[model samples]
Target: MDVEEENIESDASHNSNELGDTQRLHITKYPSQFRALANKFAHEKNLKDRRKLLEMYGNHLISFKRSILLNRKRWQQRYLRRQSFLRSVFMQQLLELETTFLELIPILNLNGMPSKNDLRINHSSDVCTPITRFYKDLLKLESDDWLAKFHMQKSTFDWLCGQLKENGQFLGKNSLMGKEPPYERQVALGLYAFATGIKYLEIARIFKITLRTTICRIMKSVAESIIKTFGDQYLYMPTSEEELDEIGEAFYSASKMPPVAIGVLGVCEVPAKQQVNSNSIESENSTIILQVLVDNNMIFRKVKLDTNQPSLFLEETNEITNLSPKLIKNQPVSRFIVTPDTYYPLRKSLMHKYHDPVEPHEYDFNEAVDHLFIFRDRALQRLFARWRILKCNGDIDLRTMEKVVLACCVLHNVIERNEKTFNEQWSKGPHSDNTKYTMSSRFKPVLNELHGKPHSWKADGASETRKLLGQAIYSTEM
Candidate 1:
């Protein structure tokens, strides 16, 4: 019975081993198939996850597209509303302009067109028009009163008219119309326009010009005539010894500062049109520099308009080199006594050198006097003040700007020469002198004298000149 049980147990173990071997054989023979099955299951799970992700992305894309369409629609609506508002504003402005035009039409008397004969007759009958009355008043007024009103004495005006006629053929008998506005009337219009800084339209209305263009043409012609006729004659540097002597004498009389051909040098900032090459729109509001030299009498002897700052011109011309002590001491000194405010090379011996006046005790008596002379001798400042009053209010082209400024300077000189008229007009003036003088803080520091340069001179001579002058003055005071 025990043997039988052992056989059974061996058979059972054999059966169990056979079963295990069969399972191992199956796994070894189909290894690739098992792996393929595992990979296939993993791929299916990955596809399911990808499908969920695609659905979520598709939903978001749809929402994004809808939002884009809504934004586009909103922007379109805003653009339409903006267009409608602009259109309404434009229409309102147009309606206002039309109303103004209609109001002016009746006043202008453009309802009915008159025949040429009737127009001529009416024009002749209206001989005592406002323009005519103004001309009559100008004629009746005295030289001082006329100068006060027009900025030119009657004699100077007549002389200018004569000069213009002789040199520029200005206001001569027009070949077609034979002097339409007449000589005196044309000159009066120009002078009045310049002195008052009036626009062409206002001048046209005052002069009874049918078109503003006519007044503009007349003013332009007059300015050109003035420039062509008198630019070289009046606005010139002293070339001859006699001329230099006269200018030096004038300077000495004014400030007791001898050998100064010109009293002051400065840059005047005048409003002008934007240059062609300038890209800045704000440059239209900026000013251009007008470099000028004036005598003791405030007459502009030299004028130059430059796009650069004033110091650049001084450097370019080597003005410091020209102002050597030897050259300054030579005949017809041609030296300019500028204020300490001027930008030039600082020479210790020069009377106009920088001096701090904060501590009066530290300054010499001569230095104090120099400061006083500089402050009081403001010929350039006065010239700029007059210019401010007479300058045109609107921006003018650069080409025309120089001519206009020159013409005004000539007029200023002419007006100044008539001292009696100028004093009377200035004292009993219809317009008050409202010009304010302000010193510019923008300036380059004084340059040092160049070494090993032939033009360079020691400041010793300048010091001696100042010392001698100071001693002379002190002796006279004593």
Candidate 2:
């Protein structure tokens, strides 16, 4: 025992000497120092009783907030899918046909010609368009697809078709040997033309009509039917006191025009098939002007088709003979404002935009008048947008332009009265970029060619009438 104690003391002395007496190899010699650390934990540990619902909801909200890019990508995917479906629908419909003549979407190509196909169909005598079969089952289409193609509801088309039979006097050949196309087919042909504005030949291909002239005849008949059936009710010039009062009231409601202010007038050019005289493809120089008057409701009161130059349609009519005096003379019972952009002939009892108005009242008056013109511009935009045939997409023939436009106007009024709604996406389409060219360059020439203001536009009297109307508009706004 004495020897062991002496050895331990010698070892400690040796270690202390070697490690400078401060360092020790057994650093964890005190195991009780770490007892509290073993008992306490830093992380959450109620594993059996804790709820994850709150965290799940927070994660969902974060995902929803950050999903805008994902939504856009999905929207694009859906649009592409719809387009692909439409293409397949038309292509498969044509491919199912027994002949090659109508196997392609002619309107998809330029000038109503189909593209080259490696698969050639042998020409045969049995080839005929399934127009009857196609027309008979149009109601089977889903409502969205129906509006996309026809620009109208199926019920509306049905009503028009029925009315046409009763009163439209649609010109058609009657024979014991062959059956005429049904009224539904005729209306379909015309409505399709108005909806698409594709070439007549392309229209023919779509309907599988062998002769392009048949398509024209069918379209003309439908136009005539529409004009004949509904023209008197919707397109008449208002000369009667009751009609004038209703129109004036509509204008007041629409643009805050004075009680006397009725019928906004404007001149617009629509795409016309190049005339035989036109050698230029520059569409700006080739368009034909359409002169029109509309009430506050954007309904056409007068449509003077092919008003190539200044229009005399109003003056030449017997109904408006007394209207001119009331408009230009001191009678405040009736008057109209010309479109702001036009150098309209001075004789039409028209009031031009403000030239130079004096004080604060005149400035306010000019603003009200500007709002009036904005309303008119919007009216015209809505009018033309409803009928794409007038927009030059359909390449309307010069001979049939009036009939087509008039028919469209009649249909527009009918639709407006019926309160039909359509998907706005249907109007998005490939319009010819060149069709956007304007003929506003010719307005100065219009004034030049007219020589001088007519007797109705006596300068002093016109000024008083303008001021009276301006004051009325300004007071209304105040």
TM-scores for all candidates: the values are 0.57, 0.63
Q: What is the TM-score (0 to 1) of candidate 1?
A: 0.57
lDDT of all the models against the reference?
Answer: 0.50, 0.57
* Per-residue lDDT of model 1, residues 306-345, tens digit only: 5445542243234422543323334322244453445544
lDDT of candidate 2 over 258-376, digit per residue (tens): 65555667677776544322342122224557766767666777777654664633342334435633442335433554554355543335655666778655676566666666556
TM-score of 2: 0.63
Considering every candidate listed, which one attains the maximal lDDT? 2
Off by over 4 Å in 2: 1-127, 130-132, 169-181, 199-202, 240-243, 276-286, 312-333, 345-348, 420-422, 430-439, 443-456, 476-478
